[model samples]
Target: MPLATEMFEGHAINRSAAERRAATLTARRSVKKLHQAAWLVNAIRCIDLTTLAGDDTAARVRRLCAKALNPLAPHIKEGLGLGDMRLTTGAVCVYPTMVRHAAEALEGSGVPVASVATGFPAGLMPLDLRLAEIRYAVTEGADEIDIVITREHVLTGNWQALHDEISAMREACGKAHMKAILATGDLQTLRNVYAASMVAMQAGADFIKTSTGKEGVNATLPVSLVMIRALRDYGAATGYRIGFKPAGGMKAAKEALAWQILMKEELGREWLNPDLFRFGASSMLGDIERQLEHHVTGRYAASSRHAIA
Candidate 1:
């Protein structure tokens, strides 16, 4: 799995077929009542609980960590009949500067600190600077590093450069898990997305993500389908399971359920866990919380009622 072009040379993504399958995913696997509630709860546990912004602060990160520790209030958990089932977001994602604050706040909460590195959102910085950023975040106590890929490599067909860069990043990460952000919205074609996904997995990414949330089109079903198919193919051939994360524009409970259904149908039940899947979302948790409130009380609450932080 050392950046071989042959692995994806003949690989072609049928856009229409992928679209059809993505369309049927939600329609065929619609859940309701208790099932919907359970899926939402699972979504909460698989969320990265992210907050990556220009204005992110230590105080904001600490609050986000607190929320990750106790995603649902005691009364809300009791109302949902959760009993002793512990619920917590998979991790708390932040910018490199906020990694230590988040790690310190989440110290013994069983929640890992995820830092968006390699010049996240745009990733236009030099390679050395990007790798150094990853190392800096890891040194600051981040257990996971979400690194953005060089889109120019994909756009210019420089697959080897992309592979080498990602492989280097994986090495820089040391023991910290590495998530390769493809920024599918900027890749321009399903074929490019498919190729990028394959290259990232081959380069040793623990997770292949869809977007950085800055692109015009972020995390669409068509794009996710292409990426997940590549993940399935990689797992089948290598016997190594790579995680998938659909970041950006996912802000509703139903959307979360849709992605879950896609994972269940494409990768089976095993991929539906936090170890293999994650939602790189911020406002999404608020909507899921609102839906959970409705599930327990039978009445929809306003968005303001379920604060994300």
Candidate 2:
């Protein structure tokens, strides 16, 4: 796991082939009725229900935590016959400063508080500053730290620099899990995405994230396919399973189903669980709730009824 450039240096990702495979994922695998409801429920468990706005407040974070705690309404939970299932989102993600509020709100509920550190959505900050940010978030009770990588490292083919930076951040994280955000949209090419993913895993990232959700293009299936393949390859070589998270620009139950399908087909059904996969979403849960309501009552509910906050 020590900067294995031989694993991906000359990797060639056929763009057209990736697109074609991504296009066929949803069409080829279809889940409907009860099966669809089941998959959506599983997706709810794997969601990093998030709030990362510039104006985020403790009150808003508390409300989001409330949602993460009880994702389904009483009526819907009853209709689905979950029977004290205690369903909750995988984690609640917020900015580093808000970690304490979210941690307090979700305490004793078996839900983790994930904080975005190291200058989220952009890793242009100084290295020491970034590591300090990770430590600060950990001190604030963040169970997971989502750190962004320097896109310039990937762009300029500085694999050692990238590995060393991520390795330092990982050490700063200590016991807290670290998710390395590739910001794949900024990486320019699928091959870069693959190589960045490999290096992040080699450097001790517990997870490799697709985007920060700020880029013009975030979490496209083709880009995700390349990343998944990289993780799959890394697992094959190291026997260490790394998690995958697709963040940003996803807001539909259908999209959730599609990504789950991709994980199932590529990495087996084990990846469908929260420990292995997560959807970094805020709005996607509302749509998933609405779809579940429709599945229960055979009638679509108004979008406002499923507001996350």
Candidate 3:
């Protein structure tokens, strides 16, 4: 199935050139608001955590990035409050090299392993190397694989090449889920994000993700909205329920809440499950604990309640 370009069926109807342009603009803007709602809703409501701490520990960022996710993954929901919101047992993520480490850290727990691959943050490696990395990650017990597309392909107008590569990566994930990271910051346009989302889905990505957590454009609501809308249309057309993952820059519980809202408006109840939605963060767990505590006790816990792996 060549990913359907008919995602814009309703908006792609025959019309005057001006009308077509207006519809395109209008559709883009509408898609824009759906994402805005994701952020806005977060400001209002709930999560696991969404921080990578890449900046907080420059000296130990590499080791810290691997360790930060450990405590959260061991017992994500263990310390959760009795309040209305929910959280993961732990949102465990690790470098590609540690897929097994992450797998061990999360062994019996329900927490799943999300391993980054494909020369992430800069999908410039040869396609053969990227697939091998993905295969190794999945074999090492990664439940999910996050791979980056060739940003150059999307920007330099080599979309066909990009599409072909994404298809290969998706097929490489025999069972584990595939999350295609757009690195939307590099694309620099919502229109491009929308188009890329469509291409990724047709190519077989199980989830459409934002960013690579490299101090670049780490996940934005608007970017998510565009992708989700395309996914929504993709689902309606193909009956395929794709998933979404937002990584980087989510550190607070409040931000998680907004993502919930974004899911509601764009993807709806069909995707509220952990299978359909997940957030990737490095330093977000402990803070989620603190936020949950604050919501209940009026005053925050004086000490950190985060569990150490």
User: Number of clashes in every candidate structure?
Assistant: 0, 0, 9
For every model shown, what is its TM-score relative to the native structure?
Answer: 0.98, 0.99, 0.75
Structure candidate 1, residue pairs in collision:
none
* Candidate 3: regions farther than 4 A off: 3-87, 303-309
Best by lDDT: 2
Q: How much is the lDDT of residue 275 in candidate 1?
A: 96
Q: Write the per-residue lDDT of candidate 2 for residues 51-79, one digit (tens) a residue.
A: 99999999999999999999988889888
* Residue 34's lDDT in candidate 2: 93
Candidate 3, RMSD to the unseen true structure: 7.2
The deviation in Å at residue 140 for candidate 3 is: 1.7
TM-score of 3: 0.75
Query: 27-91 in candidate 1: lDDT tens per residue?
Result: 87779989988999999999999998889888999999989988886767999888688889999
> Which has the greatest TM-score?
2
Total clashes for model 3: 9
Instruction: Answer with 1 or 3, whichever has the higher TM-score.
Output: 1
